[model samples]
Target: MHDERLANLLGAMALAIHDVMLPAVVDSSGVGVSASAALVVLGAHPGLSVSELGRRLGLSQPAAARMVDSLQEQGLVTRRKGTGRVVHVGSTRRGREATRRLLAARSAQLVDVLGSLTARQKQQLEPLLGTLLTALYRQIGDAERVCRLCHRSCCVQDALCPVGQAERSLAGG
Candidate 1:
């Protein structure tokens, strides 16, 4: 039976996720998610070129350039040019540290959120979550290689949200 309880649970789950994911989300100053995404790619690749970073983050050249400029100004990133418009951007020590802190905080938040779930609940939920997530992603992924291509908000929110903390409702493995 389609119950009100299910709807309330879903709404609560959505709100909780939005709260936990706030730190990791890098919304642009006057930009969109694309600029923030570029930072992740650049941070991981370190010395990737502007063009390469742009492609990796799925941003236009102008957008990537703007992101790089903002990052450089913020001191979270730096860039160097080799030759013929070959520019490389790498994360600053500050950026790497920030990433670490953010990840750790998020992990801690998740731990606190699920502190009460019994072992059985987790066991039941993991598999169901994994399967459902896989199916959802598959359905969405089949549409486009890049998420920004999809206007659907979940394209940005779902994966980043720490839904694992809600393992009790999950019907895990």
Candidate 2:
């Protein structure tokens, strides 16, 4: 049975967390949300083409190019010609540093919010969140886009990421 109250509470919680988190993420990187996400993505998977980056970020090719231009101007990223006409994007040292700071800020904000819960509640909440994330991945069908801003290493420290697990399951692997 669909619980309207549960749905409403979850929606409110998501918005509340975004409200507190986005600013810290943006401020840490001194960039917009999308740009910060791009940095994080590049930090994890460097040397991606702008098109690939756009696909992960759910952005248009032109928009991704423009963003790369902006990052290059800020000395946060560098672009190099690939095998053919493709241009690959990678973060500079400054960009990597920015990504670290952005991730740290994001973690701090979430930690603050999670601090409100008791230890037992947090332990209980973890699996529930993983279930939700897996459901979301199934619905979205794109793990990279779904986890564009995620700290990938942390999520898989002890177990496979739920989204990744969902993706593999869908692929019958």
Candidate 3:
């Protein structure tokens, strides 16, 4: 019961932080949350087919197309030719600019948060994050931890994150 309560509180805290911080970083601009997520996926894997992009972003193909459609209409993304005559989705100049602004806004928010953390607190946080991540992985398992990664790219590169575990499994590490 204690473990469950702890996990639940952690989940709630994560969601609460996201609720507060995401709007500070990304603009809604009448575009839906799914659309914003699509931009992030496209930024990671530019030139992915709508189908492939859907697979990566875990959306249905048609849903991915609709997201692309909105982005295209806004002149934020475009399609280019690919091998085997497949077309791929990528960000347009405007799209990159918008993404840049979004990232800058996010960075600013993060800076504000960081300013509140003392040097000693941050230093101690490093080890504590590892323990928390290990517990998170143990509770959630690899599939939910990676594919449904709550913070997406932020967790992908960290050595203690699930992607690292997935990669280790792939490489026999």
Best model number under lDDT: 2
Tens digits of per-residue lDDT for model 3, 1-173:
69999889879967876776578645632345555555665666678797777666667888888888888999888988788857699987777666655655655665576677899998787667666665555554553323332334555554446444644555578
lDDT of each: 0.57, 0.94, 0.65
Which candidate number has the best TM-score?
2
Candidate 2 local lDDT, 36-87, one digit each (tens) = 9999999989999999999899999999999999999999999999988799
Give the winner by lDDT: 2 or 3: 2
**TM-score for each model:** 0.59, 0.97, 0.70
Candidate 2 residues lying further than 4 Å off, grouped into runs, are none
RMSD of 1: 9.2
lDDT of 1 by residue, 1-173 (tens): 47798769868986986576544443222223455455445444579888777776656788788888987887778898878989888878876665454444444565666777888988787666656655554554422223322223332354432222223234352
